[model samples]
Target chain A: MIYVKELCKTFRVARRDGGMKNTLKSFFHREYTEIHALDHLNFTIGEGEMVGYIGPNGAGKSSTVKVLSGILVPDSGICTVGGRVPWKERTAHVAQIGVVFGQRSQLWWDVPVIDTFTLLRDIYSVPETIYRRNLDELTEMLGLSQLLRTPTRQLSLGQRMRCEIAASLIHDPKILFLDEPTIGLDAVSKIAVRDFIKARNRERGTTVILTTHDMQDIEALTERILLIGRGRILRDGSLDALKREYMTERHMTVLCAGLDADTLSLPAGMTLSESHPDRAVFSLDTTVLPVSDAIAAVSAQTDIYDLSVENPSLDTLITHLYKEYEVG
Target chain B: MKQFKKVPAHRLYGTFFSMHLRAAMEYKSSFLMSFFGMTLTSLASFFAIWLLFDRFHTVDGYTLSEVLLCYSVILMGFSVSEIFLRGFDTFAGQVQSGSFDRLLLRPRSLLFSVLVSRMEFARTGRFLQGILVTAYAVTHADIVWTPARAGAYLLMLLGCCVFFSSLLILQAGVCFFTIEGLEVMNIFSHGGKELGSYPLDIYGSRPLILFFTFLVPLACAQYYPFLYLTGRADCGLYALTPLWTLAFLLVCIGVWRIGVRKYQSTGS
Candidate 1:
């Protein structure tokens, strides 16, 4: 339920050389350099579709979220979230969206988390019955029942984050924009958050657009992925398709009786990546040679005691993608 | 789509007010210290004025009680505005910290949200002190209290609050462009309060009076209304001069709207 076309936002930043004289001169006559935070960015997200927005730092991810949430006005673009121009019809538009900036806490610092939720309830004008239902459901799902009465400052980071998420959802927004929601959470907390998000998407059909650096989050939660870099969308496809394209090379680790890497002659696509007296690791290009053929080829050299094959992890694949795209 | 009723503005404001109160109550000792500290600070300023009045029985042809009346009106107006309009007063911090973005994400008037986001209840110290001083001035100033005079007095208090509150809003609007609060803005908000403690005509300069009357409109809230209240100005229209502050408020809100539209939120 989101449409964006030719979205452009440029920021003018002051530039100066580092010196007292230069600082003084620049103070009098400053120069400005314009950075395009969003450059003709275009994307369309359908209702109830969970899409992962992946990008490196300063890649317009947060800028895109801000524009969608009505926090920033783009220089030139047409963006309508659920048929409302975000900046033009901000109040009406924002009412249908929930945003969580992981780095910022929306809950009041010294008060119980429930206080902020009630404040949000009033702020969004959520009906009493709906508010009660949402609050009860969120409290149960996020395991916030025990934490709601604690002051926000007294809670641990993970507890605070759960409360933050609940606060954003108090109005039952149709669209959810979560920017780095899993950042800094422990593994258990991350899993909890991801599970809740998945269940929410499944049960309520909430349109979820998440931007995160954690590749596992993308792998676990989203079906569709939008890879952004340098203020532009570089890739848009399903996660499985992206994995298939990048997962051509499989790592084969074989524990054998005798393996002499220097004396071994390998197939054209297979290279011995690591070697020991009884263990050898091979990087096999499965596109050129199948896993079974590589296993047969290695078995001929030595008696195999143990063997394991692994596709590259999402983190490595993403790094490879970033390098290929020349983006950070 | 589920139909949602709009929450009244007063209810939203009450929620914010109670939230802030609860948050403040968490640090009870700190709140008490600051509350009393604020009262003592304003009381010291009033004591200084009392000393000055004792030394010079009549400065600028105005009696001690008349000066006290002017001072208390400005004091009450400024403190009351400071108590409620603290959100605008400290808006630069919100903009810098990205909390203003959170406000925009809500379905409410931006101005009203900013107005209620913060309430410096500690300033009630200054407010109560102002009330006491006004009680003293009202008894001693010897003004014949006609209904019109009473109405003008109430209007003066309201105009003073609006006048300072508008200045705070104007300063907040400037924060959108600068990203930091300018200390120079204090000259108008704080300095105007100090200068307005006495009637504008007592400044004894036509240019200064004209500046306050036309530019800042502080004289409209304070001087002209006081003149009508004290029977010094026979024109009934002087009582209506406080209405000029309303126009100033409108202008300030216009500037704020422009600032919001021009706002490029800080980087996340």
Candidate 2:
């Protein structure tokens, strides 16, 4: 279990002008600005639960993950993971958790991937039997049999990401913190990673806290989504709940061959978003105007060649959510 | 299932060294060139010393063999410490590249992880030169062989390693505050190496001798221990002066812990 209350963190950033003269002057008399990276953030995560943490750039997602993983101590707050204060008992806290930073590799670049795994086994002090068992399981599950003997430098991005995930799980940590695990990965590798994560959670009851800008990773893996922006938790609920609350409308695009610009009119509660000579896109409130009625109106006014309706994509919904919370 | 026992620190260090060696071997030609380059550089210094001795039979009342003995001990100590502590030497790069975060996530001592992250076996080039100088100095220097004297020499070697390693730890610790690292620290690490290669009294500066003795403990590892070895000092206290290097080490470790705390709070 993880619990955090009123978590607050701030950073001091040095400021200087562009010119050499200003740079030299600031070196003598420096100026600094305080950035509030975390502001009274609060959350509770039960065991065996998968939560997707989403935010824009500079939204404190990484900061929150760092604090939770015992890498960074918060300025003011109470954060406890499995009944131990993370920063106060870092070794003990980190022993039960595994973290993977997609942008940074923990493996030695020139060494074979298996060499890193064995070294990590020793570092984590895994039992001989448990080590072998976990290694076999991770290798088989992640399809790492072929890549283990190869050096990390030689592996493709997707192959390397698979190995990275397997490496983090060598100790069989109870809580996994994944920061952008699917970044720069191909479609097949992305699904492989997601499926592996799901299996791990199901089999081991591992609580996972993942942060990513990729909404699909969140939609595919997490039922619960925590949206944070500008150092605050803007929304916290199930992904479905957020969608239901914020995205009641649907989008429809129509292709009409002989539509008169002056006579073309959308049905009630429909707004024309884009219009061209042969294509028109309309945003319709499904609660007010059904797709069938809107299509009938357009077809009656002109000869409709084609029409398609789709629920607002998660990207659009998230953009609307960000606007609602006044977060960029 | 069998119980899990933490790998002993020594064993872990051995594993780290082996891993480093394996990585170094990947580029066999580059490794050989680096090893040869370091050997040639140190050989040039030894030749300079030999030229000086050819002109003067002794330097500051210490015979040529005695000065070579002092220089070799300092060289071995610095090179051995540099071999194992290369990670700390390049700690600023680790901080900038964010590998330091990965180290923090591991469940081991930060110092231990940092010490083992990189090992420069090329430093063995200097080690070989130092060993050769020590062998020549031992054969030519007129010192009575005694078990007690051998023990003191071993202590001196250990002290030298600690002294140099403490300097590296201090350098790494400073990175927490100033991420770019202070080049001025070279004045101590490299400067200590250059100064320690000669007798402290040769400079004829009392304040310099005092600073090395009490502050950095260079005299403790080199001069005082040498005096006992050369029979110039009969006091066992002088022989044991090298142990004082531990006090300097402890101070460095204390500073490192404070720096770690600062890093944790700042989260850089």
- Per DockQ, the best of the predicted structures is 2
How do the residues A68-105 of candidate 1 rate in per-residue lDDT, one tens digit apiece?
Answer: 99888888989999999898888898899999999988
Worst ten in a row by lDDT for model 2 chain B: B1-10
lDDT of 2 by residue, A1-328 (tens): 9999999999988888799999889988989999999999999999999999998889999999999998899999899998999988887788899998999988878889999998898888897789899999999999999999999999999999999999999998999999999999999999999999999999999999999988899999999999999898988999989887878887788888866667667678898888898998888987788778988888888888888888878998889888888887
Give candidate 2 misplaced runs (Cα > 4 Å). A274-279, A303-305, B1-3
Clashing pairs in 2: none
In candidate 1 chain B, what residue range of length 10 has the lowest lDDT sum? B259-268
Q: TM-scores across all candidates?
A: 0.98, 0.97
For model 1, what TM-score is found for chain B?
A: 0.97
